[model samples]
Target: MAQAEGTYDEAQIRAEYADLTRELIARGLQVSTMESATSGQIASLITDTEGASAVLRGAYVTYCNEAKVKCGVPAEVIRAHTVYSTQTAEAMARACRRSYAANIGIGVTGTMGNVDSANPAASTPGEVYFAICTGAGSDARGEKNHSFHVHLAPQPSRLMYKLAVAKEVRDRLVVLLAEAAA
Candidate 1:
C-alpha cells in the first residue's frame, strides 16, 4: 500500500491517530502518555478519535515538577537532569509505563524560556524532547528520545514556540508509532 504524503494537518493527524489505534487494538496493545509542555494535547488528540478506548489506557499531564515527581518521576532524576532534558523524558516514559501497565508509553517535555542570550544554553525556548518506550512484553523495550530545536529566529515568541514544539512532537510520534507497528 502506498503511504499518504502531506504536511501534518488536522486531517492527516486524525487519520494517523486512527491508524495507530487500529493497529494497537489488533495487536491487543495499549498506550499511556506523559506530557509536560504539550499539556495533554497529545492525549486529547488520541482520545478524540473514535474507538480510542481499545488501545489508549490513559494520560498524565504533568505540567509541574511536583506533579512529575508525584506521577513517579524521581526527584533525583529531576535534580540531575533538568525537567526539559532527554533524561527526564526517558524517565517520564518509563514511569508512565510502570504506572499504567500499558504496552507502550510516550513522554514529552519542553520549555519556552525567554530567548535572551544569557539564559541557560543547554535548553532553548523552542527545544522539545520526546521519548517512546515499550513494555517488557514488546521487543522494543527501551526509550527513544528526540529533540527539536526550532530556531524560529526572526519571529520567535513564547506562544509560537510552544505551538511549534507541540505540533512537531505529535507529528513525530505518529510516524514513530506507525513504524514500530510495521
Candidate 2:
C-alpha cells in the first residue's frame, strides 16, 4: 500500500497477486474471475503459483460486451450501464460467483489508455471499475462485499495499468478477508 499510483513494478504486482493467492489457499477459499480490460491477466497470475488449483475454480475473459453477456453478465446491465461501469463490474462478479460456485469472485473492466473505439462516449482512459463479490454477504443473489471505480494515473505501459488494478483488488480483498475473519 505504500507504493504510489501507477508506480508499482511488475515484480511488486506479481508478489501482490501471488501473495493473495497464497492467502486464499490458506483460507481454503475458492476464487473465480470475470475479466475485461485486464483480460485474463489476474487469473493467470493467480494460477502461477503452486496450489493454485486448490483455490482457483475458473476464469472468464469477458473482453467484449457479447462475451460478457454470454458469460452471464446480463445484457440489460450492459445496455443500462456501459461495459465499463461499476454496475457491469458488480454483475460480472456476482454472475461468476454463481456460475463457478466460488467463495469469491472478481470482476474488472476499463479502458487502458485511450477511448474505446467500440464505445467512445462511455470510455474514459485510465478509468477502471472492479468489484469483489464474496459469500460473506448473502444478498438475494448471495454475493456481496465491495465494488469500486478508479482513475489510474497514466502509466508508462498498459501492463502497468493492469498491474495497478490487480494490486487494488488484492489490497481490497485482503481487507475483506480480514474483516470476515474478525
Q: Over the stretch 32-117, how does candidate 1's per-residue lDDT look in tens digits?
A: 88988677777776677678898788899998789999998898987888776778888888888767888777888865554423
**Per-candidate total of colliding backbone pairs:** 0, 0
Task: Please name the candidate that would achieve the greatest TM-score relative to the true structure.
Answer: 2
Q: What's the C-alpha lDDT at position 59 in model 1? A: 90
Candidate 2, residue 107: how far the Cα is off, in Å: 0.7
lDDT of each: 0.67, 0.85
Clashing pairs in 2: none
Task: Give the true-structure RMSD of model 2.
Answer: 2.7
Per-model TM against the reference: 0.73, 0.93
Error of 2 at 78 (Å): 0.7
Please report the TM-score between candidate 2 and the true structure.
0.93
Candidate 1, overall lDDT? 0.67
Candidate achieving the largest lDDT: 2
Runs off by more than 4 Å, candidate 2: 1-4, 136-141
